[model samples]
Target: MIGVMREGGLLVLTLQRPDKANALSKAMLSDLLAALDDPPQVLILTGEGRVFSAGADLEEAKAGLATDPIWDQLSNRIATLPSLTIAALNGTLAGGAMGMALACDLRLAVPGAKFFYPVMRLGYLPQPADPARLVALIGPARAKLILMAGAKIEAEEALAWGLIDRIVVPEDLLTTARALGADVLAAIPGHASAIKRLIG
Candidate 1:
C-alpha cells in the first residue's frame, strides 16, 4: 500500500506493508503512478518501517512476466517527475527498487541502510534504466561490482562509490529529506527541474 501526505509544498509517499518488508505489488505500483499524476514541488519517498522496498513482489513475478513492463513504467514515471524528487531510504534497497532510488534527483539514507542488487543471483536481467542509471551515477566498473559481483554496499561504501548522496541518522532521515525538499522548493520556481534536465 502507499501512504501519501503533504507537508507544505512537499509530498511524502511512504511504502506501507512492513509485514512483507514493503515489497512492491502491482496495485501498489499503480497507486504510486496515480499519486504522481498531480505532483507537488517536491516528493519524498520513504517506507513505513525498516525497509524502503524489497523490490517487485516475487510471488506476483513468479505468476507471470506481465509485471516487468509495469515495473519499467513505474521506474520511468519516477525518473521523469517534473519536480525535484528525493528518495529517503530508511532501510535496505534491493532488486528493482534500486532503480526507483536511482531515478530520484537525490538519495538520502540512514547509516544502517544498505544498497543491494540481486539480479544475477535471481537469474534476472535488470531492465535498461536500472543499469543505465547505475552506470551514470557511479561508472561501469562500480556498476559491475554491484550487478556482477552482487555486492552488498553499506552506507559509507555507497557514498564513496557515488551510489548515494548522503547518510543521515535513522531518526533524522525524513526531517533531513523534508528540509532538503524545502530548500528545493525555495529555489526559483522550476529551477530544480531545469537543473535536473540540464545536468542529466
Candidate 2:
C-alpha cells in the first residue's frame, strides 16, 4: 500500500506495509506510478514504521518476473522527474529500493539507516540505470563494491561516500526533509529546474 499527502508544495509518499517491511508490491508500484504522473515542486519518498522499503515483494517475484517492467518504469519516472526529489530514508534499504533512492536528487537518512544491494547475492541483476546512477554518485569502484560485492554501508559511511547528502536523527528526519524542500520551493521558480536539466 502507499500513502499520499501534500505538505504545501511538497508531495510526500509513504510506503505503508509495515508488516512486510514495506515491500514493493504490484498494487503499490501501480499506485506509485499514478502518483508520479503529476508532482509538485518537491517530492519525498519514504516508508511507514522503520523500513523505507525492502524492494519488490518476494512472494510476487516467486510467481514470475512480471513486475520488472513496472519497476523499471517507476525508477525511470523518478529519475527524470521535473521537480526536485528527495528520498527520506527511515531505515534499511536494499535491492531495487536502493535504485529508487539513488534516483533522487538528494537523500536524507536516519542515523541508523543502512544501505545494501543484494542483487548479485540473490541471483538477480539490478536494472542497468540503477548502477549508472550509483556510479555517478559514488564512482565506479565504490559502485562495484556495492553491486558486485554486496557491501553493507551504514549511514555515516554512505554520507562520507556521497551516496547520501545528510544523516538526520529519527525524530527530525521528516522535519529536515521539509525544511530542505521548503528551501527548494522558495528558490527562483525556474532556476532549480534549469539546474537539474544542466546537471542531470
Give per-residue lDDT, candidate 2, residue 106: 93
In angstroms, the error of model 2 at 48 is 1.0
**Residue 11, model 2: Cα distance from true site in angstroms:** 0.5
TM-score, one value per model: 0.94, 0.94
Each prediction's whole-model lDDT (CA): 0.85, 0.86
Clashing pairs in 1: none
Clashes of each: 0, 0
CA-only RMSD, every prediction: 1.5, 1.5
RMSD of 2: 1.5
The sequence of per-residue lDDT tens digits that candidate 2 reaches over residues 1-200 is 88999866689999999999898888898898898777678999988888888787888876754337777788889988878899999998977878778889999999878898888888888876788899999999999899999899999999999999999988888888888878678887777788889985
Model 1 residue runs over 4 Å out of place are 65-67
Judged by lDDT against the true structure, how good is candidate 1?
Answer: 0.85
